[model samples]
Target: MSTWLFDLGNTRLKCAPLRDDGSIGEVVAIAHDDAGAWLDALPTGEVACIASVASDARRVELLDALCARFARLHRVRTEAALGPLRIAYAESAHLGVDRFLAMLGLCGAHAALVVGVGTALTVDLLDAAGRHRGGRIAPSPQLMREVLHARAAQLPAAGGEYAEFADDTDHALASGCEGAALALVERSLCAAHDLLGETPSLHLHGGGAETLRARLPAHAWTPEAVLLGLARWHVLRIA
Candidate 1:
């Protein structure tokens, strides 16, 4: 029987087939607002495992669409404890499942600082023992640009190179927004080092990660971290 993994985030829906060896296959990302037309094109499978951070209405719409396409649907949620991972949240439900799963995918022998750059900038720290040490959330550079452009139409929303000191308005906007996000990640790394008494491995993911990853070359980039974690979640459940 075929099984597929779905990661539904605020801006995109990423899906991939589960390979026989339990690894995730190539990922296909779709915009939630325009996903209806593409649903029928997806290969019908025996089971669909989904981890979603989209709104309730959007999730229902997707579930309704996939009802007939898969024999069973496994929707994953944030848990206080899952396998080796122990979430730090007092109310686990408040933590986005994407963040939880991303940590799961990145967690291993060493401590890690997981950074997600998408519609929002999110950072979480996980110790070697799989204990989540909490995290921070801020507006992503793209989102900051969008909000600024929306508030002030004169500022261009997209375009401009990142610079330490930008001469023009467009570059200034880009520099300021991107700089803020970069500073946050750097600060988190410093704090993680101090907290752990050792430099934790940095893991980057999400659509906006490439820009940040470019600046920080040493960090690991796992674009499919969420899906990989979902696969792990499924295996543990069925084991």
Candidate 2:
């Protein structure tokens, strides 16, 4: 039976088929604003598994649409422990499912830092034994720009390039916001290294992660971390 995995974030909704080998097929990303109309075109599937960090109303809308196309719909939630990974949150439900899934998807036999840059910048660290070491959340560079534009009508919402010394307002905004995010990632990596007594692998994901690729050359990029986690969740559920 064909299984579809959906990862609904604050800004985008990514969907793909889960292969027999547990790998994901081609991922299709749609803006949240266009998700409802796009869902109408989704192929029928035997099962639909989702990991959503969107608002409750948005989740309801997507769930309703998925319920229409699939006989079984599984909405994955944050868990205290899933297989090897043990969540640090005393209240697991308070942890974002997306973050939990990302860690589950990327955690390996070594310490690793998973940084997701989307509507929000999320950083989570997992040790070699799959123990959650806690995480942090901050406004993404794009969100920073939006917030700036909202507060200061004169500042443009978009259009900028990162630079050490920005010559224009646009570049300044871009550099500042991007630099802020990069700084956080760098700081986290340093702290993770100190805490683990060894350098932890850095994993980057989400829509905004690409912007940091040039700056974070050493970090491994895993765009489908959340969806991959959902696939893993499905495997664990059935096993």
Candidate 3:
């Protein structure tokens, strides 16, 4: 029997098969509005474990579709504590499942500052002991551009190269927005170091991660981190 992992985010649905050795296999990303178009191509497996941060209606639609394929479905939620991992939120439900799982993916011996850049920029901190140390949320660079273009007709929503000093408006928008995200992450890292008395490693993921990876210091980049976490969660559950 095969197991599949699905990470349903604000704009996209990413799925991957849980490999025999328990690693994530090739991932397939599909937009929310194009779900039906990819249904036939989605792998049919014995179990489908999903972690969703989409709207209620969108989640229902995806679940309804999955019901036709997978015989058993597991909806993963953020728990106050799962195994050694402990969430800092007084109400664990307030933490986004995507962020919870992203941190879960990197749960290990070393402390880490996990950053997710997608529709939103999310930064989370985890100690060596798997304790959540809270996090911050802000608009991702792309989102910042979109919002700016929405409010100001003259500003273009996309297509620009990031630079320290951009001579053009497009590049300036890109530089400013992405620079803001980088600064936030760096500030968080500094704070984490002061609080923990040791600098934590940095981990980056999500669609927008590539945009900022080249600009940041040494870090681990795992695009399918959430899926990896889902796979780990499944294993822990079955074990």
| Residue-wise C-alpha lDDT for candidate 3, range 177-217, written one tens digit per residue | 99999999999999999999999999999998898998898
* Separate clash counts for every candidate: 0, 0, 0
**Residue 145 error for model 3, in Å?**
0.6
TM-score of 1: 0.96
**TM-score leaderboard ranking:** 1, 2, 3
Error of 2 at 107 (Å): 1.0
Model 2, poorest ten-residue lDDT window? 34-43
User: What lDDT, from 0 to 1, does candidate 2 have?
Assistant: 0.90
lDDT of each: 0.88, 0.90, 0.90
TM-scores, all candidates, are: 0.96, 0.96, 0.96
lDDT of 1 by residue, 117-188 (tens): 988899999999999998999999999999999999999999998999999999998899999999999999
lDDT of 1: 0.88
